[model samples]
Target: MTGVVSRAKGAPVELVEIVVPDPGPGEVVVDVAACGVCHTDLHYREGGINDEFPFLLGHEAAGTVAAVGEGVSTHAVGDRVVLNWRAVCGRCRACRRGEPQYCFATHNASRPMTLADGTPLSPALGIGAFAAKTLVAAGQATIIDTDALGGWWDPAVAGLLGCGVMAGLGAAVNTAPVRRGDTVAVIGCGGVGCAAIAGAVLAGARRVVAVDVDAGKLAWAQRLGASHTVDSSRLDEDGVVAAVQALTDGVGADVVIDAVGRPETWRQAFYARDLAGTVVLVGVPTPEMQLSVPLLDVFGRGGALKSSWYGDCLPERDFPALLELHTRGRLPLDAFVTERIALEEVEAAFATMARGDVLRSVVVLDGSGAGATS
Candidate 1:
């Protein structure tokens, strides 16, 4: 099989012949249809995530089951599915408490996908799908109904539900639980931030304020249903807070989401919420980053500060429902698919993403071509 591999730190990824072994017990092999190029893959290539070299470099994917290993009865050949990084273990403490989204023991394929020389390659996020085929724990593949809306949906668009999109949408819908008539503000207008904005709108927020340094991204946020936008490029933290509050009747928003993951943006989110409002952090921060806030404010504000892990989503429940909403023309999932490129064009896609040129550059492994299909 052919897949993208990052062989060294900061080196460009290359398409290479690889070996994907047959699924082991409780695992399944998938014929990848489409995969989204995400920031996490770039982080792996830069060795920011870990020193795991020669990593298989894509995870956000949707595909069809090609084969199933022994003891895997949950799925079978030909099932349309979306790949998820978190495959919760049923016995984990979180799972026992009915909080599988926080399950401590997520499962992945025990065996590694190796290079042509038999060197073990770590699959990015444990379910590499940049290749024509990949192996993952059966639980990692959440089946989607291709038959929905009379089978007119595209898997390439559905693949976005696997990672970044899901995280952002879940952050607003699940973590903050944005309610009807509530005012919501989302910081950072990237793929995640735009999704958060959309989620707030779908959840019936009366006003959605999108804050971002990029004018293009802010426009994108507006298309995703934001009622207002704040260009944070020229604004200080206090200014951003003031702008958000002004949109919410000088009381701040009911929920403020920080999708930028920087100290400055976080502070803006903290102060851009109402006294009892919620602040949700869905962005990924570097390890060296530290946050400092006034202890008195923590008590005086009397609101919750939460961090979302994959939007605290359960794939089984969220993926299908969100897709259904998309099919019904309620959710703008198609807007996220900025362009489509072949699997080998991932390197170029990364550059495009870094330049803030597109929301998502998906790799259409099955050769369906890029862009959304109704």
Candidate 2:
């Protein structure tokens, strides 16, 4: 099969021939329909996550089950599904406590997807879907009812629920638990940040403030239901905080989400929330970044400072429900699909993403070579 591969650190990704083996026990092989080009894949290419070379990049995906291995009774051939990176292990301590989202022992396919020369390839986030077919643990495949959603529901849009979109939506809906009439502020208006804005709206937030350095992204956030927007590029941290407070009766927001994982943005989120309000950090920071805040303020301002990991989401419960919401026209999932390119165009997609022009550039792996809307 053909797939995208990152062969070296900071090197351009290549479309190469790969050998995907049949599923092993408790695993499944999926005929991938669509996969989103995400920052995580770029991270892998740049060796930000690890030194694991020859990575099979791309994770956010949706597809149909082509085959199932032994002990995989939950799914069968032809099941339309979204691919999740976290396949919770039932015996993990977190799972035992009924918090499978934090399950430490997530499972992946034991066997590796190799290159044509028999070199093992590391699948980014453990469920690489940049190819026509990929292998993953059966639990990673969350079945979605495409038929019920109307047969025309685009798979490219459905695939986004597997990663960034899910994380951002989960950050607001599950982590912060945005309440009715609450004032919420989301920092950064990328794919994740816009989703956070949408989540805040779905949670019935009376005021949703979107903050970002890019004017285009702020516009995207508005379309996603933000009541106001703050262009952080033109303001300092204090000014950004004040702008958020100005929108919310000078008390700050009830919940402030930092989707831009920088120290300054985090500080803005910390100070942009009212006393006893919640601050959720959904953005991922680099290892070298350090955070320093006043110890006295930590005790004085009594509120929760939480970090959301994949929005504390359980795919089984969230994917289908969110998809249902999209089908009903409540959640504007289609807005995220900015473009749909063939699998070979992933490298160029990265450039387009860096330009901050699109929310998501998905790879339509079904040989369509057309945008999702087309």
Candidate 3:
């Protein structure tokens, strides 16, 4: 099968032939219908996540099970599913404690997909769904009942729940747990940030503020349910904080989420929340980034300062419920799809994402044109 491969750091990804072996024990092979181009994929290409070269890219995806390995009774061939990196091991400590979302032991295929030349390829986030077909642990496939939705469901849209979208929505709905009548502010209006805004609205936040340096992103955020916008392009850190506070009636938001993941934006989120309010950081930051906040302030803040890992989501529980909401027309999850491109155009999609011209450039594999915006 053909797959996108980043053979070296700072090198453009190439569409090359890959060898996807049949599923081993406790694994499955998925015929990918659609996959989303995420920043994490770019990070892998840039060696930001790690120096695991020859990385097989693309993770956010949905597809049909083409084959299942031995002992994989949880899913069967032809099952419609979304791919997730966090496949919880039911025997993990966190799972035993009833918090599988925090499962420290996740499952991935025991074998690696390799290059045509026999070099092992590390699948991004243990998924590597950029190919026409990919292998994953059976636990990584979360079945979605499309027939129950009562209509044609777009895999291009449903696949997004696998990663970025799930993280954003879960960040607000689960991590911060936005409450009714609460005011929320989300920094960075990218795909994940916009999803957080939608989650805040779903959680009944009285007002949702979207902060970004880009006008297009802010507009997208508005469409996703942000009641107010803070254009931080011309503002200083204090200005950004003041803007959020002004929109929240001179106090501050009850929940402030930093989706940019930079130390500066994190600091803004730190100071932009009302005293004793929650601040959730969902953005992925580089290892070199550091924060030096006053110890006194940390004590006086009196609220939670937490980092969300994949929105603290349990795939079996959250993916289907959110997909159902999307089917009901209550969640504008489809809006996140700015365009649908072919698998070969993934490198170009990365450029589009970097230009900030699109919220999500999804790669459609089924040739169905289910949710093509471009």
Reference-based TM-score of each model: 0.98, 0.98, 0.98
* Model 2 bad stretches (over 4 Å): 367-374
Please identify which of the two predictions, 1 or 3, would achieve the higher lDDT against the true structure: 3
Superposed model 1: Cα runs more than 4 Å off:
369-374
- Model 3: residue 112 alpha-carbon error in angstroms: 1.2
lDDT digits (tens) for residues 1-374 of candidate 1: 89999999999999999999999999999999899999999999999999979899999998889999999999989998999999999998999999999999998999899999999999999998889999999999999877765575577888898899999999999999899999999999999999999999999999999999999999999999999999888898899999999999999999999998999889999999999999999999999999999999999999899999899999999999998898888998989999888988999999999999999999988765353453
**Candidate 3, superposed: residue stretches over 4 Å from native:** 369-374
Which digits, one per residue and each the tens of the lDDT, describe model 2 over residues 33-128? 999999999999999999989999999998889999999999999998899999999998999999999999998999899999999999999988
For candidate 3, the per-residue lDDT at 153 reads: 66
lDDT of 3 by residue, 1-374 (tens): 89999999989999999999999999999999999999999999999988978999999999899999989889988888999998888898999999999999998999899999999999999999999999999989999877777655688998899999999999999999999999999999999999999999999999999999999999999999999999999999999999999999898999999999998999999999999999999999999999988999999989999999999999999998998888777899899999999988999999999999999999999875474332
Would you list the rank order by lDDT, best first?
A: 3, 2, 1
Which residue pairs come into collision in candidate 3? none
Name the lDDT value of residue 163 in candidate 2: 92
